[model samples]
Target chain A: MSKNDKKQQVETTGHEWDGIQEFNNPLPRWWVWVFYVTIGWGLWYTVAYPAWPLLTGATEGYKGFSTRGQVAADIAAVEAQNAPNNAALAASDLATLQTANPALYSYAVNAGGAVFRTNCVQCHGNEGMGATGYPTLSDDDWLWGGSVVDIAYTVSNGVRNESSPDARFSQMPAFGDILSNEEIANVVAYVRALSGQEADATAAAAGQQVFLDNCSACHGEDGKGDRMVGAPNLADALWLYGGDAATITQTVKNARFGVMPAWSEAFRDGGLTQAEVNAVAIYVHQLGGGE
Target chain B: MSQGDTPLYAAREPIFPKRVSGRFRNLKWGIMLFTLGIYYLTPWIRWDRGPEMPDQAVLVDLAGRRFFFFWIEIWPHEFYFVAGLLIMAGLGLFLFTSALGRVWCGYACPQTVWTDLFILVERWIEGDRNARLRLHRAKWSLNKLRLRLTKWVVWLLIGLATGGAWVFYFTDAPSLAVALVNGTAHPVAYTTMAILTASTFFFGGIAREQVCIYACPWPRIQAAMMDEDTITIGYRGWRGEPRGKASDPNAGDCIDCMACVNVCPMGIDIRDGQQMECITCGLCIDACDDIMTKMGRERGLVDYLALKDETREREGMKKTPIWRHVLRPRTIFYTALWSAFGLAMVFALFVRADIDITVAPVRNPTFVTMSDGSIRNTYDIRIRNKNGEAHKFVFSQTSTERLWLSVEGSEARVVEVPADQMLQVRVYITADAGSPAATAERTVLRFWVQDLESSERASADSYFTGKVR
Candidate 1:
């Protein structure tokens, strides 16, 4: 058949655009059936799933499915699977946990890493590499101690905090009130010399007598620091609050007081569980600084 | 012409194609066997890849994130190889379509092959075209029900086998087959097989020509790929027109026997000139040639002919040679593009390293100050061992002589990576306080890992941050 003959047989929609008329060719029956099937499926889907929004909340359909509920269930399931391990880790002795049960120790370290990410990253950083004021957990320059037991105690009671009675407590009397500005400057030079930084030799010699009288009790006579009092070692170059002349002068005048929160739930509300405290201790200990 | 007469939808017209035998039909049969054989049997072929890797020569180990084909293994990071192959397949289709017309659609398409097999089964059970048509039009009866049930069961079985073969490509064939019989295979495997089976049966047995004409996009795209020199199956309207009986005085070669239409799987008339519905299967040419020979007429009443050749023949001029038509610039360009991708992929596969390393510097606290006033930067280095046996790799730095490398848990800068697995280790690079690298804001660090046994080294460059003061 010719094109004209076929065109004449088919009806036109009577809508013309730029002199081209639209043909009213029927769609395939299968396509129309599929369209109807989709409509039916959509109607069923609304009834079976949470679809409509109301004033209070979305309408809970027959399935009662919510993404929040799904995530909660997933977390609960994982927690249930690790319940035994968590219980064992919480009860194990921090000193001998690693050698007694290496598998459980390993599990605690991984689990503690997750807890540390959520609760400790703000101060300790993501990799436990601390900032200027904060002490790096991955290094051997811990002000308190690097042993797993010491870490656990610090994490449980915290440092110089009013919340826990057993918190690691230390107080440095601010010397700005008692000592003159010249004395503070001379002591700063002496402190810098102890850490092997450039210092005024005459001032450092004079400040040595002042340091023995004022700072030797907590910082030790040799300036090696005392772990019992959580005093930082002045013999090493690792500084928590900078080793510069200006910063050292400020520290000698007013002293530094860093407060950490007690992580054990026994001491504070919303604190980490016993198992979490144990895990984080193991994780921090394994960061290459554990004794 | 009336609005009321024009319905909004039209039903599909069922086609019962008559069976025909010729060189083209035989060629289709041979291609079907060859392609199907390769599909169903490839997964079962075994190659000894040692104890650490899979033995299947052709397998898509989705769980392991690897693609194994014979001697070559592809990791997930090398998915560009798969992309290159798909590009080559597309170019090959273009090359064939430009030279010959819908050759893939006619002879080698999975749809065509499966549908042909389904038709062969239908012919064997229903006694060919006329009998099948009569049976289709006849009212429901016990005999009709029996024949219909038998044909559906056979079609379903063929579909099952096709689906079964497909799943074997993803896993170990023998174990999966045993698990399937034991009803213990993964639910996903069962679900995938069921979906593929249903689709194969529906498209091959029932949908048939509708899939190529309405569902597939290739036929529409082929229109742009073909030009006047493209040889396509066509009826010689110049010679075959004015069709009449042999007894007529002024009759043409065609006897109006409708033999070509009867043999068409697409249910299209080749005598209507070129149409989109025709697959150019050459079956019509085969059928018409048989009829022309019996009538003592010259052959090629329906044959593969280019539009340009038709114009030449009508003008009483010599036709262009087949080589000239196939070797034109368009076909040559497509062939060259297709070959280039194939060669590039092969070269990449051969030159790929057995050990791969990637270093990601920890940037949270850019640099850490150690007790000794040294600046340390941490990196998470992932080493992928593609070898069949475990190998120890010694880590070292090629740049920044002041930088010292240390592994996290080891006393020495050495790590053991398991065979065919990727292991991540924490690496610390330290620069002494007096060194220039320790004071620079950023230093380019090139870390190298060498296999202790083979000494094959792979290096990755990363930035090392240090204290600015």
Candidate 2:
């Protein structure tokens, strides 16, 4: 290598590594030209995009584009793509939601779940498991019916509320106005006995006749509450008001009719859209209770 | 003088590759036919995978996150199989390079085959090497213009076909082909085709040998992969050193004929020591052998030989079989690595699950205290059904005997997924009141989704969080 270099007399950087001299070389013209093109591209990129920091904000490039705007556009595109499915979900019945198209059903359920977390969970308890006076929606029983349309109607109109004029209406007629306090207590015992709860057998035996004569008109002869009048079944362990003797006595004295606010656009407080209403209704129905 | 005293870039000298017929040429023709045939026809072959799945025998379904190759189907979660195949490919390249240097670049590389075809078209239109040289040197004329235009158009059509065959691997070939013809395909498809066509035309036609010489990094790096035992085209310098014209009595076997130089695609003289630009194509050896046969001398004036063999010949040793040079430790190591990757990938492909499930707990308000004093948590369960048929899966949770699994609006606690699709369902698992697991602050809940019609099952575990109070 030294013999050849002596003959060629090529200039070097005068640096040697392991007897090999370093020849100072210039960048290839093609490489230099490409490097210039890249620098030009970089300048153009900064001018055409949001760049350069300022005291207030970055300089808005000529395009005036921001990642925020891009994200918003992306979101809008997704929503637009799903608009028809959303519309179908809004109009679909529960069977169609559950069976015909699981994708749409899944959309409604997820949307409904979100709605539940925001609004309905406050009254219906977490996971729609109602507390005390509020109904346990996760049960297999319902005051009216657990069907999807029934749940939709109930969610939209509410129960005996001022928001919807078509709200579920029923009155126990305040039987205490006619019967004595002792009579109310005896009827409570019989109602508890029908649901297989511990009760005074003697008082229950006497209350059975009283129940047949007066209460059976709406409560039925067997003490199973009627659905037409929006009455609850006394034969079930589930109690809308309560199963306790004291609570039943109080309910008989002045009827228990809990009110749920209307959640439809036809009601107050900037009610939900039809889609949102359907979502919450679907959510509640899926809470292990819909028949 | 400064290093910049001389120009940094040298202009490309034209290479007029004269046509030669030999065993190597026939082998190159056979290889090009096989590889190009596979590239263009693989997408059109149909493999029935039932109704809801794509039938393309070899497809990379990017949107669907699937790769289908005949009897094998790969999902995104099983991407290690693809990785394994790529590893195998890398090892295979190493194995072949150790045995025969730059064999891939010579006959099988897309660059070599496509450039050869484009050159063939040019020669057919403009005549052979001398005719082309003459035509290029001549002033522009109607005849020259017509031939140039005709050759370039053919080249462009070949480029278009090359690009057209590539897009079919990503979608249903017949439908995509129709859509491409009608301009109804996705804009990206057209953009990809245009870019590919442009690159093929520019690289295979205009760039030609310049790409192998200046642009490609392989020729620069491939020297590192070779050892002295690796077979390459070599000129028998010992026998051919004393050279002259055919009429000179002092001349050795090799006359001063430049047939080897003219026939070289790279336009480099093989008589010089090996250089980085050599692709080991053996065409120069073929050219010299024909000349040697005509001169009534030995046919191996330039031939495929290893450096070790050359050394042995210098030491007056007898020739050894080719296998003695090929079956060395480096080739054996590469072959072993290639086999390991291939075997591992095949095993993984067979054992991979067609159905997979993943459950993630909703962390915002992670646990909900039910009215009955039990704690409940919801999960987003994503089910990927890779099978060709739809399936109904029963989802059940474990970690507590009293825990109940209920799907959204589904009283049956089962989920249904379409063939080759993913379905995400919101699931609620509620612990029973007064249960030990419900009262615990945290517990791992395992949710198993089982196929109703098959024995396939996949399970995912998530933490079921609750407050101790």
Candidate 3:
């Protein structure tokens, strides 16, 4: 507390807080050395890498690094790396593509997924579950076979359309003009009974003869419906339309014929290329049900 | 000595640690040689891990995302083994530090070893302590410049080797060396070498003990890790206090020869008492012991002594055994933890799966209604084959009687996953009219993949998304 006990004042920055004076001390030797080293490093970095800005353009340092150039190089490298896989995919048969090279198969599946989202999702639902009257693409039940090549063919030519000359064109006769309403009802009941739907036994018995005579040409015996003609099997539990008495009667009266657009480049509406058609076919075929 | 004229930030007082012949010095020499030998030669050793994998005994394949060590190969997912090893190393340092104070820094640390090597080269070219100090005070001459240039060139060569050895661990050593000579190696390799070389030369040659005193945080943190029982080199103040000339018979055992001060690498006087800068290499003890023997006095004026034992000796009690200092609670704890971590990592390595299967159900539309009226669900199946040999697996599913499963592109129910690759295949599963899951909106489907040769099976469960019929 005595004035004599007070230490001699050192050089200060002329500032004091709570009686504590700030001393004008020099930096430590190691700290100064470290600062000098960083300054040297900064000078070297400016000389060796893209750094300072000028009036017209920035100075390209010795390395001449650029973000755009790096990106272009990276993209080029990736494309070069994938060129072999693309070639393999182009050469392989559509049916064997999945098993031949898994790398290319994955690439096709991924690329096909994108094409399916853009072109095929409208009628087939988002995941190809299919709305009413539209065939479910994800299922194993294929009216024209679920083989990859078969799907590819169907995708290329389409069905029941005048657009493609090679299209699968088969139509059921609308017996409404030839037969009476009673005969149409009987046939409907028989078809419903074949698929194990509730139906009138007497009516089904009488309708069997009419079906054998009129529909057996395309639907075949036992009503299995021949794949050669793309006729759906009536004996199975599946139906394109409702299987009720009224719905089937309407179907037989009108003769349901759903039309799919040909994805081949030969068709209109900006049809896909052969590669794209193959991609979408592979996509739809592999959605859990491609045979 | 006037306070007003003294510099707050003093210039570095250069150190020239005199040569000493003692057991600790010999131990240091052996450790340095062994460590440097292993570091420089490890990348050159080769081990055949079959034709599919790299042959280098120790390699860090950064591009391939694999680490190869002798017979063991580590994938990216197995990085926990590396983490465990790092934890064990940390605990090992703790264990050693609790028993022997700063022994890692004293002998085995890269900083200490490299600095010692640099100093050895400096003494070889310029001469020993007195001669080097004299040369420093003298004016610049052709002889001095020649000696200095030779020393720097040798130092630079050592730095180059150190940097070169580091980069070799990440690549095939011989091929990389050839590429380096041909200027065909990756620029990153050369840049890394330049950075490392510069740092090694600067820290080992110029910075030296300054790093331990100023830059490194270990000395500050380790003070809390030590206790009174930990062994550290210290001057026996009781025996050597009031340090008087040897002619005075009343003086303590210490002759005040200043031998310990002349030989200290840290430029500290041991007689000043215990300080943070001591690495505990025990060279001062050897120098002082030589002086003691020449004067016909008892040795250990400056020696590896525990603070507690020193206090006890001052109180006229018998010094306890060295084992008592080493065998204590913290050291035992650290040792036990380090061992436990090592054991756990080993156990994990043995039980790791060689085959893994994962299934992801397509959830966009979930299920589609087939023409045959069967409910179908799509699942993406990924099978990973971790083995070196190629293998085929039987693909099957567990479900009700009406459910049938098949891999994409084939109805054979067999799939092949190549060696060290993942095969992603879309699997279509159809559930017939009477299946139980057909009526449920969603259900867990178990898909199995069994190796044809080993019968080792792996299964994955995914929700089979469907609609109620």
Best by DockQ: 3
**Tens-digit lDDT string for candidate 3 (B286-394):** 8999898888888898988889999999988988799999988888888889989988988988888788788988777677666566677778888887777778988
If ranked by lDDT, best first, what sequence of candidates would result? 1, 3, 2
lDDT of 2 by residue, B202-290 (tens): 99989988888888887776777788898888888877878887787887777868888888888899888687777777788878888
Interface RMSD of the predictions, in order shown? 5.2, 7.9, 5.3
DockQ of 2: 0.08
Tens digits of per-residue lDDT for model 1, B253-330:
789999999999999889999999999889999899999888888999999999999999888888799898999999
Q: Where in model 1 is the C-alpha error above 4 Å? A: A1-71, A84-110, A147-149, A161-186, A245-257, A286-291, B1-5, B316-321
**DockQ-derived CAPRI band for the predicted complex in model 1:** acceptable
Q: Which candidate is the best by lDDT?
A: 1
Task: Indicate whether candidate 2 or candidate 3 has the larger TM-score.
Answer: 3
Fnat value of model 3: 0.74
Report, for every candidate in turn, its global Cα lDDT versus the true structure. Answer: 0.90, 0.82, 0.83
**Candidate 2 residue runs with Cα over 4 Å from true position:** A1-83, A94-96, A110-263, A267-271, A287-291, B1-4, B362-366, B396-412, B425-430, B442-447, B460-467
How many clashes (backbone atoms < 3 Å, residues ≥3 apart in a chain or on different chains) does model 1 have?
0
lDDT of 3 by residue, A1-291 (tens): 343333354467878899987878789999999999999999999988888999988889898788988999998997688666656665679887766766677787777788788977887777677777888777657788888789878888988888898887788888888778888888888888888888999999999988898888889878988888888888886677777787788888888888987778887678866666777777777776777
What 10-residue stretch in candidate 1 chain B is worst by lDDT? B1-10
> Which pairs clash inside model 2?
none
